[model samples]
Target: MNLRLRSNAIMAVAEQLVVGITFFVLYGVLIRSVGAEQVGILSLVLVLTSVGQLANIGFGSALLRAIPMHEGRGERHLSIASIETSALCSALFYGGLLLIAYYPFQYLITIQAGPQYAPTIAAMMVPATINVFAMGLGAVSTAGLSSIMRNDLRAVANIVGGILCLAIVFLATPRYGVVAGFWALAAQSIFVLLATWLFLYRQLPGLHLIPRRLNRTVMRDLVKVGYKLQLQSLLVMALEPLSRLLIGHFGTLSQVTYFSMAARYVMQMRGIVYSASQPILSAFSYLRESDPARQQQLYATFSTVIGLAAIAMLSATAAAAPFVGELWIGKREPLFEGFAILQSLGWLAVTVILGSYFNAYSLGFLRYNLGSHVVMAVANLVLGVALGWAFGPWGVVVALTISLVLAGLIMGIGNARFQPHGSRFLSLSNMATLALGCAAVGTAVAGYHFVRGYWPMLASGLASGVIWAAVMLPAFAFHSERGLILNLLRLRIKRRG
Candidate 1:
């Protein structure tokens, strides 16, 4: 990567790390102070907001694609106007939906949390709704910044906003409860918008946000491309929230807390992989156009590294859940149940990481396989609901895992056919690496069980780490691209030097 891209990637990782840690700490505090039920309320509201944000009708991504193209053609003013108009429309549409859904949402919350918590739930919704609108407006500015290759600014803005949110939540949740937490989130979203606008202004002093005539042609183009994307989003975005909703309705609020916390922890771990991989998507796209052979090779390497990394990270996390829970939640036993759920769904997480690369490959080749996405979406919803109802929280995760694996296989096969010959999904070496990684994880788990004290547990964890390294380093050195790992390590050392 060039210096600019490298810098942006580093900043992006930092931003995600900061935000992840903030939320992690914030959730831990909330769980300790207000109890699991209040945390469930907050988690439910946040999920609802995320699902509702899709009402933007996919214009957020549309603008990201459109802005760059227009800027390349020197139609910057028109692009700005077009994005602004789309954002305005999205905000209005989302706000209208929020208004319409308010009473019904309140009714559901009342049923779930009882009439005593109803007022708190209602108060939380006010800022939550405003946060959704703030996000809509901020999307336009962030898209513009990304198009101009100032994507690092977006990361910086997020870091600032996240810290502010953390502070607000920390200060307010003690006295005011969940309502104050939602208000903190609202402030964070608003800050993100302001920070993004400031960065955009700095980058393009001549750019204006004033309302302009709606460019019908641009609107039509965005809608044409966006509506198809929105269909997939509508289906996919509903899965997680709906799963939690089911848990909330069928199980107790405490179950919702367990389910959400486990899912959130796993998702945050996945985010680390995502942060590393996302920057490469554009690189992959560029290589597809300029160097198809190189693109195929890099895709193979990236998929292997990402898949193995996810397995290692998640397995390690699962093994250390006891320690983490001890520190974060004041009890290790309470976390075991959630950790079990994560363990049951471990392979699914790896596949989800790999599937992201596959999806990027499809996009890089300009092949949007709508059918594949549609199938994945449908399977997720149907299986998630059915299995969740039948088996409970773990069942929902099982359903998601099965759906993702099936969808990933379909997409992988499709992508392989498009690549040159000899491009395999799981090369022999890759499979061996995965096997050894799993073995290492099993060793760690066994050690945790057989060992007696904290000192022994620490030693076992260390031994497991050493064993994984011993196996993986040699495997990568001899089986795959020779010296690739060593070269990366040396380069990192040199950079530090």
Candidate 2:
């Protein structure tokens, strides 16, 4: 990657890390203040409200591809219209749906959460609904900024919004409880929505918050691409909520909190790669027509780096679960620790397949992506029911892990057909990396089971990480992109000096 692309990737990662850390702190506070059962109720409500994303009908995702391609072709007007039309459509549709479904959803929550927690959850959904709707508006701007290679601006908005969220959660949770947390989320979403639009307005001169006209051709083209994603969203949106719902139905609400918290931890770790890889989609889209060779190169580079990095991070997280769990929740909950470690392993498998996902989407291989989700949904349902029945909450987690592994394999195999000749997904180097990474994770998990005490667990985790780095260094020393990345770093360091 060139310096500009590298900078954008760094900025994107920075945004996620900052926002994730801030929210991590907020959740810690929430758990402490409101207790786990209330947080469980909060998590359940938020997950249900997240279905509001379906209102977008994949227009937001289409914008990520459409805006970049249009801008690259010098059709700024088309980009503007696409953004406005998508935001308007999503907000209105979601708003109407929420109004119609409010009582039914409330009844569902009442059934799921029971009478004691139902009122709080019902109230929380009000702000949570606004939060999701704001997200619909902000998703469009977020896509526009990313497509234009200005994630740095999105980073700025997110940092400020995260701080705002933290302050609200910290102060208000003490007085008002779980509803305060939803209020904070709503506040942060609106802040980000406004900030993102301001950034876009400054970046694109002809941009307007309101649309002069919605272009039929742009909307139609976006719908053509987005409709598949819309269908896919049904399965995609169901995955997490399904997990939580099953846990709640089969186990206790506290298990729901633990699972949700553990999943959040794993997701934040995965966010590092997900954020850095966001620009890969735009880059691949840009290169699809102009440079197939460069597109192949980009895919290989990201796949290697992201795959290895994801494995290493998740391995370390699994090993250090004891320390991380205690530190995160202010005490040791063996349930949460178990959930974190197993969820880390599951997400680790999914993270390794992210490059293939970007490749498929950028090249209009939507069927591959959709097919992967179908596999995920089926596996999660089948394994989740069987395993969950057999082993309780941990069984549910195992089911999730197994499902992710299966889905990832499906995606990888499907996308491999699209790779250029001689550009294989599992090169010798990648296989070696995966093998070694898996071994390290196995060692870490085994050691974690035997090792006692926080310091010993942390030391074991560090030792495993060091050994893995040492083993990988020989391979990276001769890797192709190493020289470019090193040279860029050296130049930057010298320039600073």
Candidate 3:
């Protein structure tokens, strides 16, 4: 089972990379043809999205938990009521809030871009906000699918959406400007909403829509689950976007420009592992420790494979960062020189990967550390803003790195207490090993910058990724540590034979 989980993690990462790169590549092309001014409204719209997702408050996680268990245990009606009731109410609430937010978008625009772009920005936020609401209609179900690892279906929808969005951006954006991007996004939302509903309805079949007689029990359950997750949502909201806001205000738009583009690639790489981790982490952490073998299952599944894959990818991306900024964005410019923020926040990627199970352990036991998540986010945001004000973009970067290290440490302690029986791996030596590896990989890649030409540097950086992965894989796969995993697989194969 651990072997399967590891394999699944790799496949999911591969799919995410292929699908995500398609979208980013198209976006890069569009940005090249028509500078950030033409389609930059998307970033502002993303600001609203970050808020809207928090507003979801873990409805997706709760929905995922409810449905499959109910299906397996034969509580179809209850499951249907839970999914639909949650989805419809979520849509109504977020949609209306977004609509109400329209008039005030001028305020948001003024904060970000000042009065000159404020009016046009306000206009764009309207459709984008509505699209956000439309997304709420389907997203809970998708989250459930992801939790169950039935994300092959969701991934298909994503791939399709990415392709459509690419065509929409290229064909419409250049001719129509930023408005085309918004309109295409709205259309894309409509496409996915229909797809999500159809998929869920087919799977559940007896699912019904009961707007008039809302199930109080289902609503209560949703709240029970969402409240625990709300802290996570809130913390993510406060911390994730602070750097951008800080950079935009204190530094030049070009600084915000370089950091934003570089950060996107970094974030996307981190996101692939995160996507795979979320679902399985929940499932594994819930296994009974009375089953000692299952404890080993958790370690083999998580520490051995997932950790190595994340480290390898992190190394590859850190090495390739300069090439992405200098050549990939289409023009050779000094935009590649200042990546301190990118490098600093890159540490968070490791924290995110190593600390993957921290939240799941808390939530699985119903410890509901919303207060902790909120506290960490607030501390990070406050420190980030203060430092950003004092020192500029680097300040925010430094603050974020400090915050994540503390956050990861805090969560590591809490998670150990939450599940002492599992084969826990958040020791000081382990962290030291990870840090040393990051330094070595980061230093080797830094040398590529001295190549003095984009084309040569890009080629070498790409090749270096292969070299690092080759070295990391054997050190991991043949570990004396997981001798049992190798033996168990052999037994299973012999038994089948």
Candidate 4:
């Protein structure tokens, strides 16, 4: 690892940590305040927003690639103008969605909440819908900052967004309860939107935001290019939080609370690696001026570290369950024993880390939509919802884990088939081993649950985590380049040199 790359990695980690902390804290407060039904409503808003996110049609990512690479003032202006036009199209799509949410389509969501809570959820559309649009707007700036590698700015923006969200949720929840949380979510989205737009417009003056005369050719190309991601967005939007709705329907709000907290924590812990990887991958995408082989080799290296990190994080999550739950969730007894959440995190770790690497691969290939992403999204939604309904909240978590793990496995199949060598170059052995290690911990936790009940789940989690850490540290010291501790040593050595 070069010094600059090492610094970039660390900064990315720090950026995500700060963002994650602020983001999850808001979730904690919201969940703590309104209970699970409210949590369900919030979950619905997230689902809808996910759909709304597609309004941009991955234009933000498209912009990130186009802006930095294009040369000359003319090229920059055209690209920025392209993005500006895309934004209007995006706004129209979301505007349409909000209209749907308000009228006949409002029944689609409200009916799910039941008559007692239906009206409240219906009213939530105002903030929630607007929030969705705001987030899409924020994507433009986030994509811009990412292109420039302004990670600190990214972190600051997120902190501001989170704070804004927290304030709205807290203040509104008092007057309107669950609806307030959604309102606050909308507020955060709006804040980010405004900030991002201002930053982007200032940064690129040539790219006027004024509506251009319609270009049918440009629209056709843009939509065609972005269609894959749009489908993926739609599918994931539906599937990701179907679990929450399922839990709300089958189990109590308490169950939803249990699942939500666990999900939030897992995301927070994993965000460090995910966020860190984003810019690195983005930079790699632009490194066509450098060696593509070397670029891939580096991506794999990062992926391996992410793989190991997943193991470490999941292990710790397993180990921390009992004490962590006691402190954070209180004694819900049956509502949260922690094993389900832990297992879910294990699945998510593998899914998310692998997905991150694949994203880079997709960008590199400009094969962003081979249909796999959307397929995975559909699978996750169907499986998650079905399992949640069948087995209750735990069912949802388990289903989610399975879906993610499967998606991770499937990501490489096509790549392996079509690579230059006619064979996959990336090592599956390390990922497989790390995966087995995770499975061992999950199984041990599950077994403990069955045999000694939930207490043993906690104990086993701790034991598995400590054992993995101890085993991994020594093994990694000699065998692995990107082991957590070694990465630090490399960073230090580079600084000295």
What TM-score fits each model? 0.84, 0.91, 0.85, 0.80
Candidate 3 worst ten-residue window by lDDT: 488-497
Mark the 10 consecutive residues where model 2 has the least summed lDDT: 488-497
Runs of candidate 4 with Cα error greater than 4 angstroms are: 1-12, 71-75, 169-176, 209-221, 289-297, 332-370, 381-390, 417-436, 439-468, 482-497
Q: Taking the tens digit of each residue's C-alpha lDDT, what string does model 2 give over 1-497? A: 12246778789989989887987887789988878888888888877566877777788888878876775566778878888777777777878888887778878887898998777977887898789888888888888888878899999999999999998988888889879989998999999999998898888777775645566777788889988877787776777788888899889989999888888787877788788778878877766645567677667666666776676677666656666676788776799888888878777777887777877788788777788788888999988888889888888889888877877788878877776542343667667766666676566555545554445645655655555556556655665545543543333110010
How does each model score on lDDT?
Answer: 0.64, 0.77, 0.59, 0.58
From the highest TM-score down, the ranking of the candidates is 2, 3, 1, 4
- Compose the digit string of candidate 4's lDDT tens values, residues 70-184: 4212255555655666677767776776676555545766666667867777777777777777887677667766655555566666778877777776677666777777777
- What are the per-model numbers of colliding residue pairs? 0, 0, 0, 1
| Candidate 4 pairs with clashing backbones | 319-462
Order of the predicted models by lDDT, top scorer first: 2, 1, 3, 4
Q: In model 3, what are the clashing residue pairs, if there are any?
A: none
Worst 10-residue lDDT window, candidate 4: 488-497
lDDT of 2 at 188: 92
TM-score of 3: 0.85
Q: How far in Å is the alpha carbon of 444 misplaced in model 4? A: 9.4
- What does each candidate score in C-alpha RMSD? 4.5, 3.8, 4.2, 5.1
In terms of lDDT, which candidate is stronger, 1 or 2?
A: 2
Q: Which stretches in model 1 have alpha-carbon errors above 4 Å?
A: 1-3, 69-82, 211-213, 284-305, 334-369, 420-425, 452-479, 482-497
The TM-score measured for candidate 2 stands at: 0.91
